[model samples]
Target: MDLNLRHAILSNISDNDQSQLEATIVDAIQSGEEKMLPGLGVLFELIWQQSNEQEKQEMIEALEQGVKSATAGS
Candidate 1:
């Protein structure tokens, strides 16, 4: 079994510049489709793996706020 989903996803976007990467992430998230989850998970994994402690905390805070706001608005 040779499944390398993360590598495949990364390789597909390796040549993308910062703006392109941002657009890719934003589009995937904004679409709100279940099929887009794997790519988003890969992106999130990369971000988490590369972030420092403070950055991780900030991300967690932002995620908490987003969840709270989303639920409250519903």
Candidate 2:
């Protein structure tokens, strides 16, 4: 079976409004299901592709901080 997970995930959320997208993301994270990771990755991919260099740099920094915080809390 040839499965395109990215396409499937994107298609599922393609029509989401801003609040719907936020709710979906929040629900996914709060649920902490492994199945949701790929969908989150696709969302991140879209954000990354649309971001400017400065925005990308800021995102990287934010991600680094989040990782550090998560690690420290563990």
Candidate 3:
């Protein structure tokens, strides 16, 4: 992420909201719980805000391909 955008998001969001997001991500990583990955919605929103539709489609396709490979390996 760009420093300018990071600054913008931090400037616009409340400190408590930022803390909650951090905590959620940390909990998800520590617990290995799929449900805790709701923090990824923030990532989706950031992509939506920053990218064009074609870019978003490419991103989604890449993620789908990554999942397929990951599960195949498992």
Backbone atom clashes (below 3 Å) for every candidate = 0, 0, 0
Candidate 3 at 61: error in angstroms? Answer: 2.2
Error of 2 at 69 (Å): 0.8
User: Which portions of model 3 show Cα errors greater than 4 Å?
Assistant: 1-36
Q: lDDT: which is higher, 2 or 3?
A: 2
- Candidate 1 wrong stretches, greater than 4 Å: 1-3
TM-score per model over all chains: 0.83, 0.90, 0.45
What value does the lDDT take at residue 14 in candidate 2?
91
- Give candidate 2's whole-model lDDT: 0.91
TM-score of 3: 0.45
Q: Which of candidates 1 and 3 reaches a greater lDDT? A: 1
Best TM-score among the predictions, by candidate number: 2
- Each model's C-alpha lDDT? 0.89, 0.91, 0.67
lDDT of 2 by residue, 1-74 (tens): 12498878888999999999999999999999998888888889889999999999999999999999999957
| Candidate 2: pairs in clash | none
> To one decimal, what is the Cα RMSD in angstroms of model 2 from the true structure?
2.2
lDDT of 3 by residue, 9-48 (tens): 5554445576786775576679987754544455457658
